[model samples]
Target: MSVVASMGRKEKAQGAEPSIAPLIELAGPDMERVNALILDMAGSNADMIPEIARHLIDSGGKRLRPLLTLAAAKAFGYEGDNHVKLAASVEFMHTATLLHDDVVDESEMRRGKLSARMLWGNQASVLVGDYLLGQAFRMMVEVGSLDALRVLSDAAAVIAEGEVMQLAAAKNIETEEAAYLRVINAKTAALFAAACEVGPIIAGSAPEMRAAYSAYGTNLGLAFQLVDDALDYGGSSMTLGKRVGDDFREGKVTLPVVLAIRAGDARERAFWKRTIEDGAIEDGDLDRAIGLLRAHGAIAETVSRAKAYGEAAVAALSATPAGPYRDALVGVVAFCVSRVS
Candidate 1:
């Protein structure tokens, strides 16, 4: 049977939320190596560099991106140690992005703790993020796969572009869904695509398999981000790892806001304008925003869109040979979209 077909049966039988534990288990030994490489590479004579990097790295994130890199490599029967290097590179890239994002977003919390910027200051955070990026590139070069390096390097540039795109789109109530998607595709999905693509590239797999992994990563990323957009308003602090309504407070024009704006009346539009566009949020504004999101079904719609992307991600896995690794990857899609459930 196909991987997706098997996944469906398992879901039906289990009738429970899908878990990432399987992927974690499959990647455990390699992940131990990846973690060591990360710590070793993050070290420097300038103690603050490792300090800042480790602060975020030690935070309780699931490390999903690097796991994807490792899982993708193993899925295609690769046995080389280069996958470990690539996985660590992917993680460093992700960690650097998070550090920079906290600085850009001016966020005070990450992974249920104080942000690196909050503790170390923005300059330290940014510089350390740059340091990590440099380290990530060095690791990529050590892998000796020009194709993998090119994919990851291109993703780095795209992630920067996406951040810029998001910055421009911030507080623009008129930002359409397409424009928002473009920002995420560059900022978030680009790295995911590169992380998964490197697996096939290192494995010397066919172009078709590489394309499949890229598609899976891209759709998974889109789904993941869309769920985050929904969770910002509708989820708990425990689930979000930050205070609820952070996006609304920060005037982030996520999909829920865009959809809410589209469906709102003139008075509602003015509310969005005053709060999101003009940065005039006041007491109870977040509650009002959540109410409007629910009233207009924006949150539900966002989750629905996320589910569509999750299905697309599962579909992309059809090209790969079926096994425990593929099954775990498919379960990951369910786990991502199931957060709102």
Candidate 2:
């Protein structure tokens, strides 16, 4: 069954399996600190900056990235408050990226509501994003760990480069799978890796432990993005937050489309070009695209790839000392892959 169907059945039935509640509960106390820091830092002398920042920050997000940071720190028994600052920094960076991404993608909605650029003008969104970046840097510096600073600052640069690469690849149906992976690694996975790594660094763990956590986050992030791409075509708006086929409408060259195009015939190739490259889509084109993906087994294969990454993420946790926090991290990997069921 598709993930949406499975979740629907659970929601409608008794004795449903648990979701990520355990992970959330494990990180609850620290997450409250992280949330408080986020709100405090989001304030500014300029009211508009805070207004725009709060609009997106206060949106109903899972806050998964920051939670991962907290979870990693707690797993290692870190005794300091630096993790709170770092978690807040991670969230600020993520929020900044979303604000800028919506503007770049010319997206109409975010988190099932009008995007900040839609409510405020694009210029306001862009400036507020810059402000958020500034705030993120401030928080990172306040942590006063050069290693942590290097990791996060490098991720920020890589993420910007990835966005540019994605822009170059956009609407290009011939974009290769390797190139697509590069985009996602830098765009999405780098921050996840960095977020996890900062925890061990702040905790004063050894290099090997730090590397393991980073590896875990990177693989988990790959799995997370792949599921999101698959859901874009297969999931409902209720499940996916944004509309179904948002990636298709934006002509973004995600993995499922990449596999489908490589396996597609000449007629299918022409169809992809007309819609994705030429932006000449008509009604029912999304249905045709989904049909092509399913016919080629692209969706299933993509999910298979995600599961492989998910497994790798689980394996990366092997060296960490076993505890509830470690178990919660493992559960997070399951949650990441189960988004597609």
Candidate 3:
């Protein structure tokens, strides 16, 4: 039976079974080093802006974004201080995006606590986010790789475009899978692709290897996002750092909702049309939407696609020489598709 048809019949975690433990083990020392650098970047300023920034940073996120950058660099055999600086910069870029996202989405809570916007208001959240972005750029420039700067800048631009695309897609119920991919690639995977690509580019690895990490990151990011979309319909608010079904509440047509709209029969279609398009979702809309998602097979379809794409991500790691870093890179495939939160 399709996963959608089997919903309410299966364990909740089974719906999105990504295992971060393996990824965490693989990250090891590098991950700890990552924490220290991020703390340094945020500093200890005792002000609302800094407090908001620090609050968000200390919210116990997985910190997978910059970890990918560092792991990819190490996999390519780059033993230098430059990657560390660049990795921190990349993380700042990601955190800045989150801060801005919360503000843009008008989110009240994050990681089970008040969001930066919730605590300090939207203006402070927006400006601090901008500060993080500026710091990211400043650090990137110091790395002295015009190549890195070019890639990161382009990624940032793409992220912005993707966010705009999603904003446009929010109220539109006819969103296609292609459009969905474009939005996610721009908003989330653009940086993932950049993270992996720069590893080899900075290390002076061959062109093929550079391309491999780039592809790997892109695929991993795609898989990651697909799982995330599914989880939004089911995962705990505390775990996802946002309320469950927040996307739906915001009028976004995620894969499940899109597919449900496409595959649902006449009556089901009307429900989506009313809820997703007409913005008439009510108190019980979440349960009803989950039912629609199952009826349309969108949930299972999304997971199937995530698994396939995750496999492709691991395959892209072949260009890296054999080693623990390579193994970790490859192992991320399992992590991507199976992640629960």
Best by TM-score: 1
Please give the RMSD to the true structure for each candidate, in Å.
2.1, 3.2, 4.6
Ranking by TM-score: 1, 2, 3
The 10 consecutive residues of candidate 2 with the worst lDDT sum are: 1-10
Number of colliding residue pairs in each model: 0, 0, 4
Which ranges of candidate 1 are over 4 A from the true structure? 1-15
Off by over 4 Å in 2: 1-18
By TM-score, how accurate is candidate 3?
0.90
Give the TM-score comparing model 2 with the true structure, all chains together. 0.95
Residue-level lDDT for 84 in candidate 1: 96
lDDT of 2 at 165: 97
TM-score for each prediction?
0.97, 0.95, 0.90
For each candidate in the order shown, give its overall lDDT on alpha carbons: 0.92, 0.89, 0.78
lDDT of 2 at 268: 99
The residue-by-residue lDDT of candidate 2 on 148-191, one tens digit each, is 99999999999999999999999999999999999999999999
lDDT for each residue of candidate 1 in 1-341, tens digit (9 for 90 to 100): 14334555577688765789999999999999999999999999999999988888888889999999999999999999999999999999999999999999999999899999999899999999999999999999998989999999999999999999999999999999999999999988899889999998998999999999999999999989999999999999988889999998888999999999999999999999999899998999999999999999999999888888888999999878899999899899878876885
